[model samples]
Target: MGEEGTAMRMVLCETEESRRTYTLNSFGQTISSYEELCYIISGQYLYFLTEGIPEGMREWIEEELGLVLPAEEETKKQLEHIIGYRNYFTVPEQRMLVQKMRTAYLYSSVRKHKMLGDLYLKHSRYLSAYHAYQKSLSGLMQLKTKEQQEVLYHTGLCLTRMFRFQEAKEFFKRSCRLKENKKCQEAYFIVSYMHGDYQKFLEDGRALSFTEEQLSEIHENISGMEERFSGSEESTALKKIDYHRKKPDDLMTRRLTWSMLERWKNEYRREIV
Candidate 1:
């Protein structure tokens, strides 16, 4: 039989009880949580389960499938498999698995996009990561506050790395408004300054009720940024342009600015915060 036919035949021959047994016995426990489900099916990308799954995502997947998702096992064999997969799985294979996890499994739209974004961000695919994060934004209200903050923060970080400073600053600002995240707030100020909106940065700080100490820190950061660019042609060129310009207008300045931005992007630790 063909592969598809064989797979279909196997599915046709399987009973719910048998499926349950297959899920439970293979993993050595009932799948009681989304974290366990995500961990096993995705093979080794444990960070996929970093965010708490929405409460509504559980009932449908569990109740309809009748397959008891097993708990995460810490057995030597399982650990070895996880390690091997991380070490050996090709990027294409991992990407394909992410798609399968999105489709074959019943994940909410927000959850699916968040998972996609996290995977892309982890791999340093900033453009794709930004797209995935953008997909999750409309559904942010459905997620908890922490999740919302995470999505926004990641989106901003991706834009920042791409050197879309103005757009990135808006996301960071929104994330800061969601709650008082020091990282988000700092990113907001840094990107605002980078985008040549230093006046608004100071205004925003005051409007947000930033403490004197926080304002001092921002000033320190500004001075540090100025020091970094002091001798660079990019900084000199940028200053000659109108202060309101979001990006460099001259071709040489654009090239120089991109190179400098790359250095700043490299300074960022590759982790979702």
Candidate 2:
């Protein structure tokens, strides 16, 4: 956090040298432009106010930043507007706010993106949720283990819902690596199984310390999927594995396998010709 008193005492920049000086005096942040300055001021004020401002500090901050601070009533109205309509902000506006919030606090953007992701996920907007989670992950710096794991788990869920099982499994794997919690471990196992790596799924379930009952539950879930998707491509792959053939199962694996086959066919076209 930038020192409020120091920020108030500092002079506005008119040149590169003065900007450098301001940055040095503030939070070691480089303020290059007017927009950057506004972001910094708002973000710093937001953080300071959230932490309880000292007496008369608010007036000084407002004066120094050359802006009128929003009153409680106005603030409430703005919050209502933002929260009431999911489409109140256009895509660009939402992105701009996310970037601007990054200047206010270390974790502000991350938290904002996570909130957006959860909202999108709840609405079944998996692609939007995935992008929001990606941004959240990108903003992570020196975050706690649980925080990182949480973002990773949710990212996996987004991918899973999109039917990108291979990518989802990778995310779940990364989450499990951070901390082998049951939720993440179970997700990883399910995703791995869904991606057609049943053997690896079973091995990892045990190696990752999942209980026997959990493993059985996971297996039963897989069995249920097999029964539900019978005669489908996924079920055919599962049946092939059951019969001991080296067949790729699951939608994603089958797609990749078919893509490879297509490439092979194209390569052999010249010989056939």
Most accurate candidate by lDDT: 1
lDDT of each: 0.58, 0.54
User: Candidate 2 residues 1-273, lDDT tens each?
Assistant: 576666432334332322222342213355444345444534443333233333243343344433344555333233223322333344665456655544434547676576566655564455666787788788765457887888888899876655466788888888898887888876777666655555666676776677778877887776675455445664344334422134443453432233223333343332234
Which parts of model 1 have CA positions greater than 4 angstroms off? 1-104, 211-213, 232-260, 263-273
Deviation of model 2 at 11, angstroms: 47
Residue pairs whose backbone atoms clash in candidate 2: 43-104
lDDT of 1 by residue, 11-97 (tens): 121213322212332113355433344345455233333333323333334464433223353223232333233323346654666
Candidate 1 weakest lDDT stretch, 10 residues: 9-18
Clashing residue pairs for model 1: 30-69, 30-70, 31-69, 31-70
- Using all chains and alpha carbons, the TM-scores for the candidates as numbered come to 0.51, 0.43
> In every candidate, how many clashes are there?
4, 1
